[model samples]
Target: MLKKQRILTASALIAVSLMFGSCKSDYEKLKASNDVAKKYREAVKYYNKKDYNKALDLFDDLTQRYRGKAEAEDLFYYYAYTNYKLKDYTSAGYHFKNFAENYPSSTRAEECRYMAAYCSYLDSPNYQLDQTNSSKAIEQLQLFINLYPKSERVADASKLIQNLRNKLEEKSYADARLYYDIGDYLSAVMAFNNSLRDYPDTKYAEEMEFMMIKAQYLYARNSLYYKQEDRYNQAISYADQFTEKYPNSKYLREAASYRKISDQGIKQAKVLVAEASVDSKVAKKLAKKDTTTGQPQSVVGKQNERSPQNQ
Candidate 1:
């Protein structure tokens, strides 16, 4: 019984090896064949059988050989989709876009253009990564909509554009918010303001406005004495605008606190600026007139009237 079982297993292995060898031999013959038509037929067979890697290999070679022929357009379209099915979206998008542009009169032009944009959308990475592909997808999708207003894919393209737009908005918002987290208050203030300006309808509007107010207040509080008055006033302005825009926002209370802080900061900054200005003028006058060895009598009298420290 053990000898018979060993024989059966050995025979099965031999049969499997022969089957693979036969398939490999056939593939070799197809590769070396001068018959483009035969290769095209085999590629389509493999594609229909869901063997996209094999189909892609065959189609990639055929596309270069079959250029300018009647079957070229169909072959090119299939070639792009074969790459798409194999998860090579970058190549797929490029070829599909090329097909649409080169064969504008083809019945599949609109579909190819849509597929090109869809491939770009598929290739778009997460928002935290560089969004170059997502931006390109938006451009491609918009172009498709412009070119094919009557095509059924236009609605879907618009929706896809909106989705990519939201991703971009999120990326921009996160980047701006990061400045605040890192204690770069001035840059955070500008970044948040620019983000809001760019995406007025972003879902983060309330949170962004509140954070912007906080950033502005912190920026003012840390600024030089001369600059703090203007900066704190700017924070107060931002808080006022935020409250007017979102009175019932969840951040309203926090926004009001920033407003109060900004108001107090503004008064304190103004007083500091005033004192610094007076001290600067006094120091300048003392420096210019105190050319005497020890101290000029007039300057010393002025210092006594004010304070000897000012001298």
Candidate 2:
């Protein structure tokens, strides 16, 4: 009887061990499924909580583990969004572009396009920088417009591109104008040239042309009398360009008046330079004569150096 009792106990122990093992296997399977669900839910939860880092980490895991799963599309969008929120613009741009390219027919494609363009825009630096990123952003936004013409974001994207272009235009104009104001005519001329070349359609083109004219005029005005003829000629050429381009410009009368003054000044300056050259020669000769004599020579100093016959 004791043997039977021991056998029954052993049997009971075996059955219980098998039952526990089976339960452990089931539990592990359920835990894994729930873990994936939990992580996904937690990603959303953290995103809502503005805990972007945690959200991003979970998103990264979801994208890697469940890329072909049912929730892949949802995960992809959130991944891009999280990067955008973190201001990792380069990553955000790539992810958003990927989403848009792969899921062109998806409902989120439009958003992805917009976000991608926005990320590129965010990557753009200030106007003082090289502007390579700014140009990229403009191109992306323009492509977004072409791809999604009916999108609600179209108007805003167009306006943003215009604003960026305006910033570049303004920076160029300001740099050129600063040179003009400081009398750095050569730099001003080059800056204006670049401004026109880069943004010929800009509203500031008129002002740029006007400034070029003004800078050329000042360059002529500041030149030495004998060397001013070329500068004045260049100044008049620019003035004529401004007049032809912007006939109704507020500066037309001013430009016309400046041209007259510049022409007259060139003639007067030439005459003054010639007379001064003659006077300088005469003075040098008188100084040599004065140096040769030990006695104080007051009589020759008072006499006009020019020959009386020429006078």
**Best by the TM-score measure:** 1
lDDT of 2 by residue, 1-311 (tens): 99999999999999999999998675445435548887788789889999898788778877877777778888899999999999999999999999999888999999998989898898888787777788889999999999889889999999989888987887788788777666677678779989999989978888788777666656655555566667778777887888898899987877776566557656765665667578987445433321111211111223321111111
lDDT of 1 by residue, 1-311 (tens): 99999999999999999999999999989988889999999999999999998888899889889999999998998999898888899999999999999999999999999999999999988988899999999999999988889998888999999999999999999898788877777777788889889998988878888887777766665556556668878878998998998888987777777777667666765665567577987445433432112211221123331221222
Off by over 4 Å in 1: 1-15, 277-311
What's the distance in Å from true for residue 290, model 2? 34
In model 2, how large is the Cα lDDT of residue 87? 91
Which residue pairs in candidate 1 have backbone atoms (N, alpha carbon, C) closer than 3 angstroms, thus clashing? none
Error of 1 at 283 (Å): 10
Name the weakest run of 10 consecutive residues (lDDT summed) in model 1.
291-300
Model-by-model lDDT, in order? Answer: 0.81, 0.76
